[model samples]
Target chain A: MTSPARQLRGKDERAPVALSDRAMDNLRFIRETMERSASFTHVSGIGGVAMGLVAVAAAWAASRTTSDGAWLSIWLGAAGASFALSAFLMGRKSRAEGVALLSGPGRRFAWSMTPALAAGGVLTAALARGGHFGLLPGTWLLLYGASIVTGGSHSVRPVPVMGMAFMLAGVAALASPPAWGDAYMAAAFGGLHVVFGLLIWRKHGG
Target chain B: MAASSGAVRRRSLEPAERAPGNLDAVHGRTQESGPLELDQLIHERVRLGIVSALAVNGSLTFTDLRDLLGTTDGNLSAHARRLEDAGYVACKKSFDGRTPRTEYGLTEVGKRALNAYLDHMEAIIDATRE
Candidate 1:
């Protein structure tokens, strides 16, 4: 389904110019901005607790099985480290800064990264065992983006646009069949993440 | 223009949206060009916060309102004046020996305005449901 966040933006502009003076426009802008901020940042990011759980599970999974592939174990360790560190930084930012970390751009990034990271880990394992590594990363991105957009929009987050855009590119990549799935996954997770994270930091710095 | 006229050297910041129904129509015309309207009374954010909080809490002291909304003394005092002017809330100031104290609660009029606002919200939801 089309997202509510997109609908809100379109619905806003469709209102007649004759409705009120420029003053009305200004008020609407302020109110909508506030509402969207509250939805994306304050309400939607309540999943930091779940992210904490993922960190624990990754650490435990890495510990329990010595026969697991060494590289796979390392990847799981990195996932655990990154998730714990992100959650820690976010938690500190939320409490100290009074602006919740799990909300807004941070939350959006976390949501997008989760499925991509998971699929990447799985695909890396499967590819090492001799299989076509074409559709995994793209599928991960497409699904992750669509999920974030769907979940975030109900609460009025604007960050889902970023997710949707990345997902669309992922769709194109998969349809055209990229030469390497790992490269595509790296682009979606590492490159796209660094870029969007920097953008968010610039716009709303810690 | 009127909300920030000479009497109150404010930043020309007109607060947006009152109780969202007939109350808004009354405030719109009056705030534009007429005597100060009662609908304009609790529209300011701080005052509205005070009212909404009190509506939930029954009563709040001056310090309580200040702590809840994080407004400075002078900032809250100015907005409280508007509410008081319209008799939306009854503010009582007192002194126990040396320290100062103040308590505020919704007046009959304030209760009615809050009720009207809730009713307006219910009507909108009901209409959407239909």
Candidate 2:
């Protein structure tokens, strides 16, 4: 079916000089160029899968730890390691693709995502200070998901979808018993990452 | 000359439908033309593409812009030179090792022009829909 714009264009032979179908075409071209420029296209799919693997390992290690401190330490270490690995991989991919890592859309993406992550850091300290160990996983997932959702607005399509999945898992973790926290982390961080990572890899390329 | 001026005034006042071919009749020559009239400079396809792409990007290398637009080197060069001359675009030339790199960016004047152009197009769409 022809669009409303097309219909409008077709309705008038008398109005050809101004406000023609050519104007619509120009608008479409400009809109498309802006959208492409705004999209953060440097997300590393392989990095995502590798991060998931690290999360899975961290979850296993956390489960084996008898003390809450040790569990937190294990997960924190994993988080840092995962971040470094993802940064390295994403940088490599961006270089290979000839897209600057910290310019244009990438800069916008980082700006959008930074606030939630900063809040997460602040809240993590606050919660741990209060001995609220069980709440950590839920808080982490929720904030991380929020970051992804906000930043993913400037990223490829699937990034936001993955953010939504993380959010659902966060909600589930919050509702379930504290003993089930690690499992939820496994499912959301590990499983979702691998699934979406593979999909992004195949679709957007590694 | 007096009779000719009178005829021109009369034609300008005539209904737009009666003078479809006459732009000056439908949208008369004025100190400030409304949004229905498109900016002639950015109206062309290739030039419009260059401006639109530069609007969102911080800067783009000549090679990058050519690849993005899918245009040949000479064609891109000619259009880019036009924009550069219009003060709507800025060009920077530098060397990356042995290779010389030419980068292009949109100027502030260009940004305002593009914004005005976009406003005009949007106004057209809104008018059409109505």
Candidate 3:
């Protein structure tokens, strides 16, 4: 059995390990709560840059095409490539950050963004079939922006702002002459992506 | 007959004696009564951090928890083991290709305990303010 003096000394030794005051504990609790509930922080800046480059390339390729069919095909191909690149880069970044690909925030972002993308796909096919190709750029930008804004609500702050920018570009593309469609696409997708991607990269780290 | 009667009396009296202690245990403060009995297991900073993180993420790998909690491998392992032993957390071992990976998630008991702990702390804060 321990002596009373030894027990008293033991208690004294252990005193420092005790929980901190109420304020500190509350602060810690609040912080942990936020960390748990917040969206995944692994949105890939490099992925955005890659997507931007691909958009620039697609714009260049589409501009060289004389027929509407060829232009549509080129842009569609670019879309597929962008999707693949984004998935690959996001996967890499998520792994590096130890965030699951299907984490709560990730799932939320996908769910919110997927509908807009799906709508864009349907609208693209319909617009192309109807020979309303001039409106295609504006439609794509608007829908893509909508998706981003909706989805980015669940992502980091800049994402939604980028989405809003895309939406505005879509409106301008619609107001401009049909001849300016591809230029608008190039500007919004290529320019905005590179700019925002750089910002996210610099501010949020890789 | 007398001996059996005394045993029954003690058994009946046990709960009455234990009732106030239980209240003290839940409140985790004893200035007005006896001593507070906070769950010492989770009161420690590192252990609480680990548990709190797990409570939110649903599951986390050993490396994930280590990075999140900023703890060394050995320290995390020891605390995780203690929580595991208490049935407050569950651990699963698997392989990612050739590499072995260990993942942890809070068990039901842990979730309930964490909720109770939070509520108790809030109560303490409320009482102190009052």
Candidate 4:
């Protein structure tokens, strides 16, 4: 009911500021800074599950192919699709959290993962060029695991663990016969993704 | 002229003696209320920002702290120096390749002080609600 000018004069007559307002301002400042400094841990669980499903399908389709070229084509298609899906879902999650998809911790996460993924890409091309088709699964799993471990360092707990699981599967694939390659891909990419995806969803709110 | 000069000296000394401009002032301000004392050192805007950031991030480079707080080099250094002098923060000087890096972190004393400060603020909010 007080006039604006009267309220201003009344406030001036009192202490320079109210303690409650000052405290509230300080708390808000602290919260915003903490949020800014936090790592981007919103790697999507649903996205991971979806990627797993796609990988499973790719493995099935690949197993039925007559030529090595056809097998590679199926997997490459799945990788592309999975990457797109994960990126889209991650972007959505970032938006929901009111965080930028490409700034701060998100940028750090991407930077950490880049080298391993780049290595994977180059190795994939070189191995394929050499007609080293049997080595593809182990190489893919190992390098992809390396990428996850590095990137997931900036994400949640299960992410790096998932990467380690992939690395273990890669070691197994490398030690086992080439005939077991598809199975290792299925277990590592499909199974690992689904299991850890569920964990991340439950723990991190999907 | 001697009396006038003496008066000026006394006047300057009065403010310094009365204010003291540190923990004593903080104590005097809070003496009015029994439970409303705040750590004036950390109550400052920029210093509070520095402490809060370090509390969350564990450690931050000087550049990171400055950029995060949107403060200048001189301002940040001054405030950070105050915190370090109080034993509330620690500073490490290192080199990244050829570039010099200064990292700052909240010490144990600082963490406890921040916790106390937070508790005091929450108490104020709660008391006001009543």
Candidate 5:
């Protein structure tokens, strides 16, 4: 069967086309260029919210712990949950969008994000070893912020802004007293995640 | 079967339907016109979208193109076949475990044609604006 596209072409040929064919071509070219240059948009707002909730719970759990080791374990558990949730949600979004998980923009996002997370891990270990656990909150927030900012450079726009907000919270955490670490972590990771995650969902879609 | 073969023969004879490497005739026409003429094969909206998407994305599955263009399977398949016949696109058919998967990518000539088409459009816009 002649396709609908072919039928449409036949009709156009029999009539005086309203838009000159050349003009149509120009429009299509502009649109396609823009589409091609856009970043991968599979990041999930719901995933961010989920991570935020986990962070908040981790903060609450850490507060109840008597030892720094137990506190670290709770936060570490939150980190693992966040990673898994983010990956699962991102994969779902990619599939829904018909984009591969390892597409060009996705690869760029991953490449830009890995180093910051690695640094965060190294710093966490070293700080814990040296018993300078109070610095952990600031370092975590700063590095996480740096990761988001760097990755967001390759992702949608709001991500970098969120990253900057996390960085500012990190700076505040650093300057505050050691006793305030849990509260600052809660604000940065928990509050910021929920707020910005909602913003991303509203602006960029789920 | 006879009708299908006849359609193929007609497609083969059309000047605009020339294969990619044999684009000298089309280019010669463009040189005569002062600006390149757009490839009618790539000019239609659905076809244009398919080529444009493939030009940017290294490769896309049949489902990917269908979803991107919001077209029916029959529609996408027909258009894709036309592009493939023109030597403008390369198609790879494979099995992903239990299901068949078809992927499409722009051929080198296809890329050249798209670039030329864009340049022609730009030139027309420039001429009209002036």
Candidate 6:
């Protein structure tokens, strides 16, 4: 049986380019592949780790009872695992540079999101601790959106605009407390992350 | 796998006609001009590493090249052997201590070959640029 790597390398060697065609078509494919490779796990990891940490924190902040911590622990583990799996897969792709690195910019591009995610997390933690139940969720959404937009890859469509929208919504929530603050937060950060992360992750497998 | 250092040594007996760095590639192209020079060489990553490392530094120890190239001992040795057969690089063994070690280098011919390969790439880019 032929080795899978051998087959892939052979295909890579044989993959045609139009010698006379002055075509940079392969450049887009390379960039898209690289962008998807870097963004999926990194974005997922951020969302996953953030979700896990917040769930546990929120649960503790909500109840005086230990049961809340236990409940929170479940979410932390689930999200953490998803983050880890994505991270591992992304690492594997890095070894094949012709296939991945030449394609996209990198995960560090996603790392630029620190200001937004951190700002959101800190605000949420403070709100939860202070018993300001209404603001905690809104803060998370705003921050999540802001971070994703700031740190997200250029290759992905609509990430920056969506992030801007979330920041705007967050400002609105703070200006006037609303009944749907939590939902908005989830929509901005958690929902957007899960949605985009899943889209990128699915592309990796297929 | 064939240790045909003799072929490479004999080829290098003719004093190299190319300029040291940039035009070495151009002169190399004129010599081969067709598809025959690198026919046996596959231009794989590890081999690229060996060729690249040799091009920059005229010689390297097997351990040094292994470290620079980031490959397992067997993997480095295998790729080095292929390049050696193609007359693109040369490796020789010596004692580092009680243990044995190997050293490799790009011969003048190998340097000419790498220059030729790079010239080909630059030509492609130059063609696209215009």
Name the top lDDT candidate: 4
Error of 4 at A5 (Å): 46
* Candidate ordering by DockQ (highest first): 4, 2, 5, 3, 1, 6
User: Tens digit of lDDT per residue, candidate 2, span B12-63?
Assistant: 3134334222223122234355223446677667788889999977788898
Listed models, DockQ each: 0.03, 0.20, 0.03, 0.23, 0.06, 0.02
C-alpha local distance difference test of each model: 0.52, 0.78, 0.76, 0.79, 0.76, 0.50
Please list the residue runs of candidate 4 whose C-alpha ends up more than 4 Å from where it truly belongs after superposition.
A1-37, B1-130
lDDT of 4 at B8: 16
Question: RMSD in angstroms, all models?
Answer: 16.9, 13.7, 16.0, 12.8, 16.2, 18.1
Compose the digit string of candidate 5's lDDT tens values, residues A172-204.
989999889999988889999998888888877
Q: Name the regions of candidate 6 deviating beyond 4 angstroms.
A: A1-104, A121-133, A175-179, A185-206, B1-130
TM-score of 1: 0.37
* Candidate 2 chain B, run of 10 with poorest lDDT: B1-10
Q: How much is the lDDT of residue A102 in candidate 4?
A: 87
Name the candidate that leads on DockQ: 4
Residue A43, candidate 3: C-alpha displacement in angstroms: 1.5
Tens digits of per-residue lDDT for model 6, B1-130 = 0112111112211222221122222222343444323322523557766776666444678877676656899998888898898787877888968898778887777777666555444443343333
Q: What lDDT, from 0 to 1, does candidate 4 have?
A: 0.79
Interface RMSD of each: 12.4, 7.5, 12.2, 10.4, 9.7, 14.2
In candidate 5, which residue ranges exceed 4 Å CA deviation? A1-36, B1-130
Query: Model 2 Cα displacement at B52 (Å)?
Result: 2.6
lDDT of 2 by residue, A64-130 (tens): 9999899999989999999999889889989998878986688888899899999999999999999
Worst 10 residues of 2 chain A by lDDT: A10-19
As for DockQ, the candidate ahead, 1 or 4, is 4
Q: Please list all clashing residue pairs in model 5, or write none if there are none.
A: none
- For candidate 6, the TM-score is 0.38
**What are the chain A TM-scores for all the models, listed individually?**
0.48, 0.83, 0.82, 0.82, 0.82, 0.47
Looking at candidate 3, what is the lDDT of residue A160? 92
